[model samples]
Target: MKPRTLVIGDIHGGLKALKQVLARAEVTAQDTLIFLGDYVDGWGESAQVIQFLIELEQKQTCIFIKGNHDLWCEDWLKEHILDKTWLFHGGQSTLKSYESLNDAEHALHLNFFERMRLYYVDEQNRLFVHAGFTSMHGPAQEFHQSNFKWDRTLWEMALTMHKHITKDSKLYPKRLLLFKEIFIGHTPTLNYDVTIPMNGCNVWNVDTGAAFTGSLTIMDIDTKEFWQSDTLVSLYPNEKGRNR
Candidate 1:
């Protein structure tokens, strides 16, 4: 049997938490790991988390989706100047992570960033994006690239729906109907007072708030079986994550 596809949420540089979730998920060489982005910022090991992910690719199939923060990091890498807004939102930690890397390592990490996708849709029509998708006209590619990593309307609309029905349902975003399932991780589930993966209108939000007080989540796309780490702060006991 083929290994399952595990879609993970925002990590925010919580290396320990990332490791814990992966171990709990029982990921194997046959498994496909799809990271929903925000791999850096917030915690002390942002740099290490990226390096760990790079190494993991050598053994497992890993798909990375670019997030808003990841885009900020890209800008910083090219300009070598920190944007104030980015700095305000835990960007300092990402910079700190890169400061420890040597020249060659920096290039490799940059390559990883450059290779990130705005969104990934598998053969099964399972859509994976860092944030929510916008527009009711067509598929993810029809919208702007930023929409893939920054829009929250998809999840927000799902939240307002009374149930999770898919066929002929007017309560949810019509664009979502294009896929069998849509997986995203930008809007943390913690805001809903939940720390685990959540489902609304056939959309699954796996970001259990690893950047805040919640844990990180990794869910099997088909079975919906999932795993979560302890509160992110617990993973990095010594550091205050984004002071959140």
Candidate 2:
């Protein structure tokens, strides 16, 4: 019975911030880490973030779910979406993530990313979705394959279907809500606090929009304890050299 349920919010490529937060969180071998998606885009170190995640998965019980950003990445790679948008949204960082890898290694990562699940569930707790789903489907995990995978509409609909309670807040709070606490990202917080009020329901917005700021946050699901880091990092060699 591990006491800590470390759930990381949307990273958005800020590897240095994420690293500092992880260190402050003091992850241990006994601790299980659940990653909410959107690990790429909008930061300087998308490649490092992905590679770190891959390594962590090998060493620990890391459960991850997909975000819309991830889907878009796949779509772009598959020619379903424009690559320029991906590049513009820090996709270059992701591309650079494979700079040291050979062709085979890059392809392996591509395959791994492609096979990522949209959401995950346990008998006691569900995990690691970049955004949540709402549907007539009985359980949260019971969403249809296509509906669950790339359908933001399905997730939004499920929130309404749950009939969760909500209210208008200072930050555009007219949205609907949900019953279950779906760990999510995508929508950013105004102050970059790593918390967003999407529908004011059980859903928790964890992206914190680090691409615009330096704070990357993680919440302990079991205890609702939150942690963050604001370390700065530069991506380009020139930037690094100048800072040094």
Candidate 3:
């Protein structure tokens, strides 16, 4: 089989959904998996998700990009301090998930989080980031690193200019011109009433809202082919899963 480069969206601790999507995608060790982060904080298996990914990395080529939720989890792992805002947004579930992990396992997961990249630009000039960057020059030139994990302006601009403006037009966004394509996952497509990956201009958003009531997605970057799991609410029926 030919090697493939697959981009995955946010897991939000839905380990079952993540597993289902990977199986549906028929992912192989020969493929390179680029995960868009948010591995924790939503469902009840954040720790399990991290552990699974850690094991998955041993056999498959994987690129992990850090997301905003992952950053908050990392901070708590390192400092033992919980942010009220984080708790309100789903950190409580993550905290409960970690209760089953030993100190050694926690240390391993922390190391995994610390090693994640803010953004990655491929040799083909395709950018894979957990979220969007603000720099017109590219993510490397970004002034505020946090934007790499939290900015929505880039995606918004792409949507607004999608088919309205041509690349040659003076009104075209300089930031959009920097990459051949961009893949991201901070924002969910369900917000716009979509369950599949959403495309705007050269940007593709793969987050289909697995944290709440949607599914987890994995896409083949070259073919734009994608696979998704069943709705998270159905997978974990008893849990609210960040729906609150």
Candidate 4:
């Protein structure tokens, strides 16, 4: 089989959904998996999800990008401090997931989180980030690093300018011109009533809201072919996930 580059959406601790999508996509060791992060803080298996990824990289090439939720979880793992907002937004579930982990295991997961990249620029000039960056100079020159994990302005601009303005137009966003293509996942496509990956201009959003009622997604970046898992709400019926 040919080596392929696959971009995955947010897992949000839905290990079952993550597994399903990988299987559906027929992922292999020959493929390079680029995960968009948020691997924890939604469902009941936050620790398990991180554990699985740690083990996965041993056999395959994987690029992990850190998300806003993952940052919060890393803080708790390193300092054992809980943020009230994080707790309300699925941090409690993440805490419960780590109860069974020993100190050694916690240390390993913390190391994994710390190693994640905020953004990655491929040789082909494709940018993969958990969310979006604010700098017109591109992510490398971004003044606010948090924007890499939390900005929505880039995606919003893409949507607003998509089809309305051409690349040659003076009104075209300079940030959008920075890359051949941009792939992101912090903002769920389900928010716009879509359950599949969304494309606006050169930006592709793969987050299908697995943290709530949608499915997890994995896309072949070159082909734009994708696969999805069943709705996360149905997969773990008893848990509210991030729906609460």
Per-residue CA lDDT of candidate 3, range 114-192, in tens? 9999999899999999889887778888999999999999999999999898999998999999999999998999999
**Positional deviation of residue 97's Cα in model 3 after best superposition, in angstroms:** 0.5
Give candidate 1's root-mean-square deviation (CA, Å): 1.7
CA lDDT for candidate 3: 0.94
Candidate 3 at residue 201, lDDT?
97
The digit string of per-residue lDDT tens for model 2 on 150-196 reads 44543354345445433444432222322235566655553434243
Q: Which ten residues in a row have the lowest lDDT in candidate 3?
A: 133-142
Error of 1 at 231 (Å): 1.1
lDDT of each: 0.86, 0.60, 0.94, 0.94
Q: Candidate 4: give the clashing pairs.
A: none
Evaluate residue 182 in candidate 3 and report its C-alpha lDDT on the 0 to 100 scale: 96
Candidate 1 residue 197 Cα shift, in angstroms, is: 0.8
Backbone clashes in each candidate structure, one number apiece? 0, 5, 0, 0
Q: For residue 25, what is the lDDT in candidate 4?
A: 91
**Per-residue alpha-carbon lDDT of candidate 4 for residues 37-87, written as tens digits (9 for 90 to 100):** 899989999999999999999999999999999999999999987999889
User: Candidate 3: misplaced stretches above 4 Å?
Assistant: none
Q: How do the predictions measure up, each by TM-score?
A: 0.94, 0.72, 0.99, 0.99
Query: Model 4, which residues run further than 4 Å from truth?
Result: none
1-244: candidate 1 lDDT, tens digit per residue: 5679899899999999999988887788999999999998899888899899999999989999999998898787766768898898899988888887898988888889999998888998888988876667644445577888788888887777737554675654677678888899999888889978888877899999999899998898989989899998887888878755
Candidate 4: residue 82 Cα off by (Å): 0.3
